[model samples]
Structures are given as C-alpha cells and as structure tokens.
Target: SFRFFQLDPDWISCLIDGAFSVGRVTAADAAADQKLHQKHVAGKQPPVVSGFLLRSYAVKGWPKLQVDGYKQTAQDEADMDGYKLKILRLAHLSPNVLLCLFEGDAVAVDIHQKPEMLHLGFEIPDTKTPDNYSKNLRKADGTDKDNYKNPWAIESIQPDPATRVVKVSQLFLDIEKKAALNFTAPFTSAQFALSMVEGVQKVRFVRSGS
Candidate 1:
C-alpha cells in the first residue's frame, strides 16, 4: 500500500544538501489514525485525517542511515543556521512522486498571499543498514547533536511485482494568489529559508503514489 509523509522544509533542505542525519517521530505522527481508531471504538470524537503513525507505518529493517556526498551552496549554508528545523522519517511506502504544500499567510483584511518558499529534490544513496547502526547513532560528533533521538533514513521497497524503483519526478514551489488580485513576485529558496527562520508558519511536505 502507498502512504504519505509530511516533513519540515528544513529537513527537506538537509535532504537536498546531504547533511541531514535525523528524523523525528512522535505521538502526533499517528494523531489522525489514532483519533479515527478512537472514534470507531467509542464514537466519541470526530475522525481526523493526519499522516500515518510512525510506529505502525515503518517498514521492517528500516530507519537506516548512510552518508551521501550532498552539498549545499554557500548562500544556503549562511542562511540555514537561523531556522529551527526538525528531522523526520517515514518508512514502508515507496513514494513515486513528491509534492510540497505551502500554506499562504493572511496578508490583509480580504487578501491572502503566498509566503516565500523553495522546492528542491535530489536522489540519495539506496537505503542500507550500517554495521554500527546503533553505535554510530549513539556517538555524539558535535555536528549531529540530535542523532540519538531521531531516525535518519527511510526504507522503501516494491510492494508488488511491477514496481521497480521509487523516485521523485517533480519539485517546485506552490503559491496561492487571489483570483481577483494580480500580484507577481518571485521568491528564492534562501528567502524562504530566512522566512522559516523568522517564524513564518504553514509549510509542509505532501507525498503521493506514482
């Protein structure tokens, strides 16, 4: 079966830069399903549609970590330090396409404007388990301080005979403009990263099946 995972833009940037090494999972990870399960069992609350739970959704032999020679531009490196981004992982489902969801901010009394956002995608090494998976995670190397607390990789496998390799085909920024208003302003990834660092809200990842 196919599934979707939501990620922070900072983590996504790290994925693009090849320096990220942690992914966080929490009770909120399965909040939607848990609420639904509760509703079905007791009919007490409304059904909430959220991402799949990490505990149940993760594939076996997953949460793998590997080093890929991914690098970011000098501008990106200079701007990344200000944002408080979280690392997260989703396993089990091998996504064939990736989508980014950017929520517009309320600008005026009747106007909503798109915030600065950047879209990027890249291929990493195939998922594999390291010989010192647990040991490497435990060692604090001053670079990845939260390594012990987060899972660094996702494992993807073909669920059927037809599917061969899972890859991302699309990467672009999504912005909403008021139909009645004609506003055209182009923003770059660096600006988006700065906005995120400045506490701009409503940016997330949306994955789909191929």
Candidate 2:
C-alpha cells in the first residue's frame, strides 16, 4: 500500500475553484433533490459554485416567489433602480433552482436595450443573515470606520467543507456588469434573462405559482 502525505496547494486551489463554479453557489439548496445531494453543507456553509474569479452561487430553500414587474410591458425600463422590481411570494416552497433575481420598475426597464443588455446580470446573496455579514465587520479597536470597507451586497455565497463557513466572494453579473458589480448589486433577474434572452421568458417566476 502506498500512502501520500503531501498536499499540492495549486491543485487543491484549482479543484475547489472548479467545484464552486460548477456547483453554482448563491442559489437555493432547499430543493428536495438538491438539498439531499448538495445540502450536506454544515452550519451556514453553502456550497461554492466558482472560486477562480471569486464568483459562486449559494443554494437555499425559498418559496416560489414572483419577481413582479408590475406589468412593465416594456423591457429596458424594468432593470433600473426607479423601476419596480418586487418579489411576490407564491406559496409553499418547492425543489427548485433559485438564481439571483434583479429588481426593476418600468423606467429603467425601458431605458435598457437588447444586445448590450444581454451582457448584464445580478448577484443576489442566498441568505441575508446579519451575523454572516456583520460578524466579518469591525476591527480590534471597533472604531475605525474608514479603514473598513466590507459592506454588504446581494452576492452569491459559499461554505467551506473543511472549515464550514459561508462567504460571499463576488456579485453575479453578465460580462458587462462584471466590473461594475464589484461595487454595486448585479442587474435584476428579468434584465439578466433579457440580456441573454434565449429560452428564458420575458417576465418570469422561479417556480410555477401553485
């Protein structure tokens, strides 16, 4: 029998990074199948989707919520801040994939156009636990606000199998919003799909309203 005791830092890093990417962290893990398969995360540890670029999806269990556009009728206008991007709850939760949903009213939705819009998306955090975010804030002195810049945004999250800690790396975004997302929230869910409008619906819901 041969025993190996050495660990390759580069290989381990790459392997974890790949797991996070393919895993799609930040998304919900509450689905029956996904939870059984991928929900083994300990504590607040959500599985990381991607690690290389600091972007990953965290999975959780949430109701079949509706991202009500309030009848945008138009597209571009719904992706802006002034736009009404609201999440309406449908019913009980189900085994579904919850991606980061963006909020847009009407004006912003109208302003955004296609082709370029496809290059935008949003980054939503799977969980909004204050401890998960605030615990990381503050310094030893507990008085240096300037030195600290760890603000909270709706980004994906991950859990370390080894350490069992969930963390947010980067906000989800299309290639275009990648740079801007670092400082702000990603685009709304509808905006993200329209930007990539393929099989996605113009206005959508995570799960069918039951």
Candidate 3:
C-alpha cells in the first residue's frame, strides 16, 4: 500500500548485482526476542535482502483486473482471507520491494474468482540455530506479533508501469542453471531481467470456481 517513487537506478543496480552490505536488525524488532537480539548483537548473522514475492487479492468496488495480460477469471474467488502480503521497510529507504532471507517454492492459486494470486514461500533451514533471524523474529503477516516462528508470505500489488513480475520459482531455477554454467562470472541485471521474463511467460492461469 506504500510506494517509493523513482528509486535510484544505481541503488537498484547494486541490489540486482547483490552488491549491498548486510544490515543489523532494528531495535524495535530486536526488542521482541531477547535471545534473537543477543544473537544479532553478537554478529551471529546480519540481515540481508533476499527475494521478493507478489500476489493479488480482490476487494469490493474495485474494477475488473488484468495483470501482465491475465484477465480476472473468477469474480467470486477474491482473496478475502485475513492473510496479507508482508511489507518491510529498509533502513532509510521507503517501502519498495519485498525481501526474503531465503529461497523456496512459489505457490500460485486462483481463490474466490479474483486474479490468480501468488505466494512466495522461503525455505529457512531448521536447525538448532536458524540462519534467518529476521524471519524467525516476526509473525506471518509481517507484523511484530511477538511470535517469531511464523512463515513468510509476500503479496504483490499491481506492477508499476516500469516494474516486472516474475515467477519466483522459475527465476530461482534459471539463476541456478546459469550459475552452474558461469560459476565465476557475476550475475548481471540484464540476465536477471531475462530470467524474469522467461518466468512470467511460463505462469499458467486456472480458474477455480467460487
């Protein structure tokens, strides 16, 4: 629901190139779990931007929708559930892109006849100590619910004219395949955009009845 207009292209370039440095958790977030806070302070791990997830929901009174040329197929299947895509605020940056700490399967479904919605789920390893401390420090809805074990779900809004929505799974796979071939070369934005387009084109829409 919040927007960051005209983000610096160089910064965006840095993000796509994975050139940014990791940051520490916020004081407010660290306050939620003391053990997690201690871990954060002890430099066990630093917060890093991971991946982004996108999904759509239906609301009453909104006009019929089309996303990336996919028309609204089921009017009665809008996502009315309380679950919302979690939005995170970067240190000094405005709310821009959704970030995840890990990678996992992306789930897509048509619910209540709304647009086909996508859910990006990150797979954080289960161990005595978790690598994704930020994920373990927040609730499912991206709120500070004092519960740290909730899974991450990111919903996408309509893409801005310049923004592109890509299938997370496909992009991940493409990146992996490319990395295997060019292990030493740095991944470029152009390559990422190419992967994104490939992924978006592969999404199949199915109409689920209300």
Best by TM-score: 2
Ranking by lDDT: 2, 3, 1
Q: Which 10 successive residues of model 3 have the least lDDT summed? A: 102-111
Can you tell me which runs of candidate 3 are displaced by over 4 Å?
1-64, 67-177, 180-187, 197-210
Q: Candidate 1 on 164-203: residue-level lDDT in tens?
A: 3322121113211111112234444442232222211222
How many clashing pairs does model 3 include?
Answer: 7
lDDT of 3 by residue, 165-186 (tens): 4355544444445332233445
Model 1 lowest lDDT segment of ten: 104-113
* Clashing residue pairs found in predicted model 1: 23-87, 23-88, 24-87, 24-88
Candidate 2 structure quality by residue, lDDT tens digits, 86-105: 43222222234333222222
TM-score of 1: 0.15
Model 3 lDDT at residue 174: 43
All candidates' lDDT scores? 0.27, 0.31, 0.30
Task: Please provide TM-scores, in order, for all candidate models, with all chains considered together.
Answer: 0.15, 0.16, 0.15
